[model samples]
Target: MTSRLVEHLGPSNISGASAVEIADRIRALILDGRLTVGERLPSERALAIELRRSRSTTTRVYDILNQDGYVSRVHGGGTRVALPHSGTTTVDGDDESMIDLSIASMDSTPGLYDATVRSLPRLAALRGTSGYSLQGLPELRDAVAQRFSARGVPTTPEQIIITSGALNALNLVLATVGRRGERALVEQPTFPHARESLHRHGYRMLPTPVDVDGWDERHVTDTLLHGRPHVAYLIPDFHNPTAATLPDSARARIATTARNVGTHVIVDETTAELDIDRGWAPRPFSAFSPEVITLGSMSKIAWGGLRLGWIRAERGLVGRLLATRPSFELGTALLEQCIAIELLQDMPALTAHVATRLRDGRAAVAAGLARLDGVEMPSTPGGLSTWLDLGEPISTALSLAARDRGLVLPPGPRFATGGVLERRVRIPITLSPERTTQAMERLSMAWSDVHAGDEPRTLALPHAAVI
Candidate 1:
């Protein structure tokens, strides 16, 4: 745990800072979601050594944190992050109102309500029998397999396993393939919860850099050949945050390298179908090699509340997942599967609706952010968000200030495996055009406040469950 704490703390250059500065930096980490609740802080002596400060300074900082309800120390239990007095908003009062940009889900598709209505008869027919299916509903699994086949990846119903959502599918994959202390290759500034899940499962992450421009294929191939990680997780098509798609040439290199090194690749295609303006669509990563496992979800295309996601792997791996799934969950809900079956049948219509929504959203967010100086938002052909470079390393401070002004922005560090990417932040283009304009106005004001030295109002952040 001490070593993990040191790794998470990562290279803090607070060599000669005052106790207050140290406390503020630590507090910023906690608020930014990098240092989660109940995580133990390093021992005062060790932290003092790392920060090159006196033991008294470290002790004083701990005392200050304890006084402010940011941490609690037991005689032998060590110090842990704690909830603040004002409770979960992280700002004094005003807990009830704020625009949450942390969640990247889009609204339900136009036909979702109709689909739910249409699924009632099929659901009623299954009410007499047992609803528990460890693998998933046969019809839905077949439909999902057919969807994959349509996308140019040959698949069968036997190779598909349904799960609650993409995160659950990811967890199951990690649990099945990952061993304790093994290396897992991930894109730098990738999805935050995926990194959290890897950490929870005891995998040491080796990051490969990915940016708005696109993947550095050479770096990825080199890492795969040398790092020899047990698994490589990638969001190749319409990637999250950055919305950069990996070119086919890069995909072939990654696939060939992984196959040579015996690294299993897990491709997340949750954002693949959200194409708004990309002229060409690449085939599934698994199309290059049968060893690759692919994950897809209806959350992005249809609705997140439906809680439908599926994993496409070899039949043997699917059987293994089915056998081990009971320990975690009984099965996906029967109604969600039925609804998914209905939704999959008319994907053309649903996809068209999604494309229109995301196109307008992309234009609105890009245009709004363009009005602000020093904000660099790259235009993406697909995906739900933009990775914005703020031209400064004030992401955590900006997030804190935004909270005070009634907007919730996830800091850049929230997306990183380590304590880096402080100059970048992800802004979702999933809001209405009007709301996007309003949020940008508020964000501009918050930036100004932060730049002018206005501190975040001290409050307790909500407790996030450990992954």
Candidate 2:
């Protein structure tokens, strides 16, 4: 565990920092969702050895962290991660004063209430059975399959497995197919939790760069050919943060390369339908190759609280997933499955509602960026957030500065695998227009503070989970 924590620390320039400064760096890591909550920290001696710093300095670092409620040292458990609780503000609890931008999600869709009320009757019918649906309700799976078929991929209910969410679907796939020592190709500045999941599954990562301009096709094909990673986890449509969709040609090239290399391509389409104004979307990645595994969820299109998602794989792989799923979870909630069926039928309405909200948010964010110098928000017609180029590596500093003013913004580094991407940050379009305007105002003030050389190390930050 200590070795893993040391690995997570990466290449920190800790040689010249004071103990307080070192503590601040670790605190920033915690706030970024890299260190995470409840994880054990390295012992002072181990950390000192790894960092090549004095034992006294390491001891003081832990002391400062403990004093700040960032850690608690149990007599025999070593130091465990934690966050300070306060009456006025808290990381683990609710504090209405803070504008949390950590999660890129919106409120329930306008039609969610009606959908839930309609699903109640279906729920009553399920009481006669054991309520365990390992492959999800038949109706829901058919609905999901039909939607996939409509998108140009021929799918069947037999190839679908409903899970709690997209993340859960990914986990089930990993558990079934992950080879501990194999390599997995992933996107740099990809979904943080997805990266963490790959790490936990023990696949060494081969990161391919993805910027606001989108992916480099040559790099992807070359990596697939040379690295021959066991799997490639990609968000091809409306890529998260950057909102760069892969053109059909690029997808075809990647799919062909993966076939030649015998690499499994796991496509996350959670953000696929998040099209605000992108008039057209390419056919599903599966349409390019039958070997592709696609994960989809209603979290973005509808609401995350619904806790519903599905995986579309080949029939044989779907059988493997169903066989392995009981070791982790029995089945996805039956009620959510029923509700998803209704939601699927009303996707046109849901998409229109989401598109309107995203449009307003995009405009609000653009207006806010205009007030700040050097912060560039790219053309984001879709996806939940836009990746902002800060024009300098001040993302962590700026995040801390924003925290002091009641805006919780995860630094750019949080989105990447290692502690990099300081020149970028993700601002979600999930917020209402009014809240986004307010967040930008606070962000502008924070930018000014950073430029004025106001110290941000002393700022107290609430540690919220990044979705």
Candidate 3:
């Protein structure tokens, strides 16, 4: 494990790099999720020997890291990783002053409050009963089923199982059908939380590359044929971070290959309906293969606070999911389910409101990227974020610099495994126009700082290629 962390640090001695530089690199690694919180660090003596640096240098590195709240040294626990406390302030003073660009979600839709109010009546009717719906409310299931049918995948209410959210639904699916110590194919530069979920379930990931353009059909098929992973977790529609959608032909080919390999395709459709002038929509991935288990949520289209999502699978698989769910959660809240039923009734208006916000937010990002030199912004047809190509692998440095300037943007490597994708950064299109532009301005300043060498020089993993 220390060797891998050392490898991420690259060749130790640059002409003038010092303990501060080393600490900065490690801090960026932690921020990128390359080194998880609570993971142990190598002893200073051991790290010094590995890096061919003096023990004093290693001590300073740890001291600097500890000062920044990135690590803690217990009596006999050695040094364990940690995140800075939320109350920690930046150079500018208060933490609240920072413009957080990490979350890719929006405020409640214009219809959410009214929908919640409408749902109260239904909630009152369920007050006398147990209120525990393991399979979810019948009305919400039917509404979700109809939405799937409209998306070009024929479905019945029996095929849907509701959960607390998309992540919860995903966890339930994995708990039911996932195999431990097996291979799971995932997209490089995919959602970080999904990667964490897959890891917690004991699946080793075989990552396929995805970029602003989209998937490489050849690479995906080759990986499936060669890796023969037990499962493939995909965000096919308006994929997170990159916001690239898989085309119909690619979807069909991937589905076929996965089916042939006996791989369960878990397609995350959380960002599916966040369309803003994409001018087209592909069929639900399940349409390409009946074996695909699709996850959907109201978090993006409606509000994250709503806490509602559902899974669409074969009735047998739905039963398995229901059986596995109670071990962790009794059921999704009844009131939230009722609100979802009402929200589903007004999806058209909800989606339209989201599209307008996304459109403006996209414009804000484009305008912001316009001011930065050597940064390329892709045409985001329809998604919640714009993936910027920085032309150089300086993303980690840029993020640190941004944080100093009161902006909290996740570096590109945060989206991938093993600290790769340094040439890319995902800027969300979910913030208000004003806040988005402000973030861009701060990002511009941070970009200048990175090029000026205010932050340490970091390297991507040698074998990890940015697509």
Instruction: List where candidate 3 sits over 4 angstroms from the true fold.
Output: 1-19, 31-37, 45-60, 67-69, 74-76, 82-88, 91-96, 456-467
Best by TM-score: 1
Per-residue alpha-carbon lDDT of model 2 for 225-268, expressed as tens digits? 99999999999888987899999989999999999999999999
lDDT of 3 at 108: 88
RMSD of 3: 4.4
How do the predictions measure up, each by TM-score? Answer: 0.93, 0.92, 0.91
User: Which candidate would rank higher by TM-score, 1 or 2?
Assistant: 1
- Using alpha carbons, what is the TM-score of model 3? 0.91
Whole-model lDDT values for every prediction: 0.82, 0.87, 0.84
lDDT string, candidate 1, 1-467, tens digits? 33554455454644566787567667766765667779888899988777667899999999988987889999999999876866354443344466678877788988988899999999999898677567889899999898789889888999999999888999999878778898899998788788888888888889998899999899999999999999899999878778999988889889999999999999999999988889998988998999899988999999979898989999888877887788888888889999999899998899898888877777877877776689888877878788999998888778777777777787776777546787898888777777777678778878888888887664536423211
**Which runs in model 1 stand beyond 4 Å of their true positions?**
1-5, 12-18, 74-77, 87-96, 463-467
How would you encode candidate 3's per-residue C-alpha lDDT over 1-467 as one tens digit per residue?
A: 44656755655323246898778878877765667788888888888887888999999999998987889988787898887765543345343476777788898898988998999989999999777688899889999999999888999999998888999988998899988999999999898888878988989889999998899889999999999999999998888888899999999999999999999999999999999998888888999999999999989988879888899999888878877887998998898899989988887788889999999999888988887989999889887788989998888788878877777667786787766787899888999999898888878888888778676322221111111
After superposition on all C-alphas, the RMSD of every candidate to the true structure, in Å, is 2.4, 2.9, 4.4
lDDT of 2 at 44: 92
